[model samples]
Target: MTATTVDMEVRGPWSLATGRAFWEGFAPAALPAARGDDLTTVLLVEADWSRAEASVAQDGGTAAITVDGDGDLDAAAAQVARFLALDVDATFWPAVGERDPVIAEVQAGLPGLRPCGFHSPYEAAAWAVLSQRIRIPQAATLRSQLTDRHGDRGAFPAPAVLRGLELDLPGRKAEYLRAVADAALDGLLDGLALRSVPPEEAIRLVQQVKGIGPFAAELVVVRGANAPDAVPHHERRLDDEITARYGDGATVDSVSAAWRPFRTWAAVHLRAAREGRLHEFG
Candidate 1:
């Protein structure tokens, strides 16, 4: 396939090099070529349901993307931007550190780090289903099995494909996966729609799906839609981190006010730091 290539301007302080560390460690859905400085992956463009082999590398303020597929190139580029958080204008992210010392330390530790997310809300929902009640390693193995059996290349299966399959997964996960696919096809899982509203509203809406609950809904909205400012209210680890970093009286509501509109970034940073410093290790 002839590749359709484009160069996208990434706003604010960003680095594929620094962000690669997190991607390499992110286990829900392993990123392609995450071991390298550049990012290479097979993306399932939700706009037209076309599969593309995409490679992205950073040069200064721009992300150069080369895509080989028969889908909408514009949509592909936009999806790539969302996936890598290039669409977010994080120029003032550094300023968030000035207010909070912990944030400052985390920023200093993981400079130029942007939270990379699932390719789309559809995939995130699918992962939420797969991961429930299972260890990450087991879930990852199941995801790999599903991909090998049904996905195009390494991309997760399209909605129609996933919906049609009678998967042999544990519990009622297969039923839940179909429900997720149904939501995706019905536009309930569109990234734009999910990200357009308040994070709370998005979570509420996503929970309407059969298998999605508060935790899964938050996963879809905050990480799946890649809402830059969304807070993970249900994350126990974040709560623990807050108590450990701040005082025992510290709470997410009290401390996160300092985080402001970049709350998601702060939350991800805290989690990464708590999870053994992916930035430094990788």
Candidate 2:
């Protein structure tokens, strides 16, 4: 197929480096190809999928993600936007920082870093199972194997396409992915399904699946749904990181109040800071 290219402006604060790092942070093989400031990925926007190459560069206060692809140019551009988290409302940063002093310090260093996430909540849920209880590298290998064997076109399998397939991961992980794929195909785990209730209740709904747990459900909410206020607190409520800052780990939900409407974004940056370093997964 002939390749087509398009360009879209990524408004607000953004950095190509942090975007690429977030993409490759969890697993490189599952994400796009990042060379310097350029990124390339096969994306699924709605029904159409495209193998798109993009160059993210500064444009005054904004950035431009120029996309070249063999599939629908418009769809590819939207996918690129979703993958890089370009459409998020970052105007809440100022209010968030003012609400809490500690977040202000962390936000100072981690500008232009959005969630940097998966294509959709369904994709996030599938990945959560594949990577469950395993290191990222292992998850990448498993994801690659599944994609190569079953994906119609692109680096990751589509919901309907993956529903009929299976993987060799431990226990019911593979089956769980297929189940969620079915749910995705049925739109049972879409944004509305998750957002219909509060984040915590949504976690319970997600845990209805065979393999998903509290941590994985939280992941689905943040990464899959790109939920602004949601934090993966199931895995981290009293870690030294929050206690050191807020002086009360028990009040994590209250502590996160300061980062209201952007906790997912803050959580990612805060975790990276807590690690003491940001290693490029690329």
The local distance difference test score of each candidate is: 0.86, 0.66
User: TM-score, each model?
Assistant: 0.95, 0.81
RMSD of every candidate to native, in Å, equals 2.0, 3.4
CA RMSD (A), model 1? 2.0
Kindly give the stretch of ten consecutive residues in candidate 1 with the minimal lDDT sum.
273-282
lDDT of 2 by residue, 1-282 (tens): 444444445555677676666566655344544556555566554435334555566555565656665667666565556656676657666677787777788777766677767766677788888887777778878877776787646546777777776466797887898888777777667654675577777777777766787888887777776666676776553255677666754455767766777777777767656654535331
Give lDDT: candidate 2, residue 117.
Answer: 70
Residue 227 lDDT, candidate 1, scale 0-100: 88
Candidate 1 residue lDDT tens string, 127-163: 9999999988888899889988999988889999999
Model 2, C-alpha of 268: deviation from truth (Å): 1.5
| Candidate of highest lDDT | 1
